[model samples]
Target chain A: MELLANLALGLETAVTPTNLLFCFAGVFLGTFVGVIPGVGPLAAISMLFPITFYLDPTAALIMLAGIYYGTTYGGSTASILLNIPGATSSAVTCLDGHPMAKQGRAGVALFMTTIASFVGGSFGIIILSLFSPLIAEYALTFGPAEYFALMVLGLIAASTISNASPSKGLAMVVFGMLFATVGTDSQSGVGRFTFGSMSLLEGFGISAMAMGLFGVGEILSSVGATRIAKIDSSSAKLLNMLPSKDDWRRSWLPGLRGSSIGSFIGALPGTGPSIAVFMAYAFEKRVSKTPERFGHGAIEGVVAPETANNAADQTAFIPTLTLGIPGSATMALMLGALMIHGIQPGPTLIVEQPSLFWGLVMSFWIGNLLLLILNLPLIGLWVRLLLIPYHYLYPAILVFLCIGAYSVRANPADVLIILGFGFVGYAMRLADLPAAPLLLGFVLGPLVETQFRRAMVLARGDFTDVVTRPIAGTVLALAAAILVWTLVSAIMRYRRGMKALTRNPTG
Target chain B: MLDRDYRDIVAGLGLTAIGAAAALYALFNYNLGTFTRMGPGMMPVSLGIILAVFGLLIAFPALSRSGDLPPLKIRPMIVMSISIFSFALMIESVGLVPAVFFTTVIATFSETRVPLVSALVLGAGMTLLTWSLFILGLGLPISSFDWPF
Candidate 1:
């Protein structure tokens, strides 16, 4: 009852003419940016961060949230229409969505994705509104050791769950952490890896790294590969937009399961929608009565991961808003936006700024509704975006990348760093290393290091305190278990590969 | 004598050597007295060692493997390297708009194109849109707008 009352208050705040306008602008801009390859919600949100500084906090947050959710919905359009995933979370969508497009069911895929995203997003918002404060209060008890342990678990989960070898993923994680050490040490005020360069003082910016790795790396890869855009020539009728009765039956269970799984995983720090989407896809396959239907234009394949990705994207905000710790890069950018507005997002935020908090929440629901209404009618327009030539698209994307990089601190050096990281990102892709862990490591590295040092100082250099503290101890134990499990799995897979090779022995 | 795994082995060994040297240099320059209270070199030195170990791991595998070596795509690799280097060099001098426009045009050379005019138009239009949205609207300070309207 209180939730409903609070929500009504939130709606009153968000539906104001000014806030509503920003929400529409945000979703519109979000869909545009989200349709482009390489540029994801993180880059778009970061690019918009400076603009949000002057707006009312509620309106600014509403706009940013709109971009976040809108991008998730928009990512599916490219994956279905062009066989190109505009964002990493949409990668799984390509497997089935592209196949559906080829079969002239592109409209169905688009419609289903929009519906699933709306459902999942609505579910996630409900969960966030009900549970965010409780989760924050619980997280407030976590000490430095607990935080370190949680990060370690996150790294292990990311490495093992990624598409590449655990070794490569771990290597990337280490590389990212090393990169994080390049700037001045917060504790001692001394430089570690800068080698006396003044640019190293501030360390590598997250926006620069994200744009370089995901944005520029994508351009380099696209340049190297030949991709002919596939446009569905068949005219999709309005009647074909809705899923078939059988399709709905197949999709509902997966959608529900995905929402549950995504919300749980999204609440954790460091993991994001990509991980949730992958996990949902894998889970749907594991539990399906007919697993082989999944890579062959199955509607369930499209629905499950799309739902999970949006759900994870929304719920991931819970940690960022309530605890001041961002669960993903997009959320981190949102946190950065809040800080720029002189509003620190943490336990006191709700009490200090109830209007802002509730207003933002209210706007998410409003934003989701706006997205559905905006996307449904605009589906044809979005599909037409696929007709745009890649040559034209890539250059515009590059310009946006450069501008976005420059906007961060207004430094030319940041732009250079973006370009440099872009090359490194391309190299990493060529080596088949996952880029997500690197981003995670880069974002969380400083926080983890600071926490670790603080814990040690508090404990007077007693290392045992890392495990002796109860909550921290449990988290460390979980991290250790993950590490052990990963090692065991790697060794098993290596032995199995060796055995298979020896048995074939030059046949 | 070069083995089939020579390239991988060489790359791995070179990386390992570089990592070790970096670690040693960092350790030598680090103030251990201050490090007792938690210093800058602590994390870097640890990471350097870990990197060296991973490099050695790659080196060991490369040394042990026997196979027909896959040839590195030198052309694409070189093109990519030069593309990146050119972007760094050109971004400031030419400003964001022209730099991005020209760099992207060059990047497209990797693909076989039928008509040159189509590619140029595509690139120019993309640059215009980006300039309008990010620079003009967002005020990113990316262009001097050298071209006359």
Candidate 2:
């Protein structure tokens, strides 16, 4: 009864003329950013964060949330139409989506992706509406020790999931932690890594780093790549694009399973659509009757990862909204935005700002509907977005990135740091180290350190509290298990490869 | 293909050296307190040591490897590095609108043979739209370089 009443209040708030307009605007902007290849939702939201400072909190949050999920839906368009992925989450879509396009099924791929996105997005919203309050309430019981443990779990999980060598991932995490220590020490008044620079006092800006790494790095990588190709659409028509009966049958199960997997993974801190999409792809490959068809225009391949990615994109909001711990880079930026608005997210947010919480949740469903409507009839329009030449598109993205970084603190040094990180990011990419773990490390590094210090203070310098407390202990054990499992598996694989090499030395 | 083990060795050694340098610098400037009560230098110093260890591990494999990996493409690296630096340098003086427009135009010309007029128009139009939406509509206070000083 209370849930229903709260939802009614939410509906009342979200349906207001002002809030509705912001929702529409956010979704539209999201699709535009997602359509463009270089910029992702993380950059878009970070760029938009400062602009939302003047708006009502409800409207600001609704619009930001819309952009986050809307980008997931829009990202697939480029993957299917062109061979390029608009965002990292859409990388898997390129495998089968491009093949489908080559087979003259571009319209069908777009249509099915839309339907799958809607289904997955709605399911994620439902999970959010049902479980967020419970999670928030549970999170309130956490002390500094529990928080530290949770951060450990988040860091380890992120490192293990990174699509690179674990050593590199660990190294990046440590490097990020070091970067987090660059500003003034919160406990003491002394500046550690600032080296007497005033700009370093505030530490590195998240917006600057994100813009430099993802935005500038993207343009740099595109310098010698093939020019963005135009698709021949003389035979393409919407009427003939709807999914067949067999397509529907294959899609429904994967959509449901993907949503379930995504929501579960997303609920955990630090995991996001990238991991969810990868997991969904691996799962689909394992279960499909003809698994070899996966990378060659299988409709199920398109539906599974697309569904999971969107679902994870939406549900990843749970931890960010409830616990003040961002589950992804985009969520981290949203957390930054919320802090700018003077809204501290946690258990108290539910009681203090029920309208904001419910209003944002309700707007998600409305935004998903908006995305479906916008993407389907306007599929051709989004496909046309790919026609823009890279030369023109990348430079504009670079401008937004610079402006966005500068806006964070109105500092030029922030822009420099972004560029520095962009070079580092490019190097990391060249070395085959995943950039996602670096982001995870940078965002979560300070939180873990702060919590660890606080726990020690509270326990009178006793480190055992992290493992002595029941909740904290359980989480620590889980993290340990995951780390151990990963190490064991990696070693096994290494040994197997070595053995294969030795056996084939002569043969 | 770059030998994974060899690459790891080089990375590990480099990290170790960097970590050692950082530790020495911090120790000279900041005090390292007891293990029970960590000072400012404690975490970084400890992290540096760990990195050094990993670096040594990486170096062990490189020491044993005889073959060399192919050299990385320097063109993309140089191009990208310059582009990022240019973006940071020009953002404020040129203003977001003109700065981005000019950067886009230059970057486009670096690779493909885009018509100059088309690139200019696209860059200008995008800059205008972003300026209006982010600055004017959303009240971001983005300044224009076109104003008479």
User: Which one wins on DockQ?
Assistant: 2
Model 1: per-residue Cα lDDT over A1-507, one tens digit each: 877877888888999998899899889878877776545666555554545544667787888888877777777887888877766789999999889888888888888898898988888888999997777678777777777776666666665554356655666666677778777888778877677899888888776787788777776766534567668645344566877899888999999998988888887765678878899999999999999988989998899998898788778888778867665556756666677567888777776777788899989988999999899888877767767666556655665666567665766677678778877777665555567667766766787788888788777788886779987787678767866876688667656656655676542
Please, what are the lDDT tens digits per residue for candidate 2 over residues B1-149?
33344555556667779778777777787767654556777666766676666556445544433334434556656655565566566666666676666656665555546788887787778778777876777776657664435
* Candidate with the greatest TM-score versus the true structure: 2
**What residue pairs clash in candidate 2, if any at all?**
B9-B58, B9-B59, B12-B55
Candidate 1 collision pairs? none
Q: For candidate 1, what is the lDDT?
A: 0.73
State the TM-score for model 1: 0.87
Clashes of each: 0, 3
Please compute the TM-score of chain B alone for each predicted structure, in the order given.
0.69, 0.74
- Which stretches of model 2 miss by more than 4 angstroms? A38-56, A86-88, A228-230, A234-236, A282-293, A492-507, B1-7, B34-37, B55-97, B146-149
* Error of model 1, residue A82, in angstroms: 3.5
Docking class of 2: acceptable
Q: What TM-score did chain B of candidate 2 earn?
A: 0.74
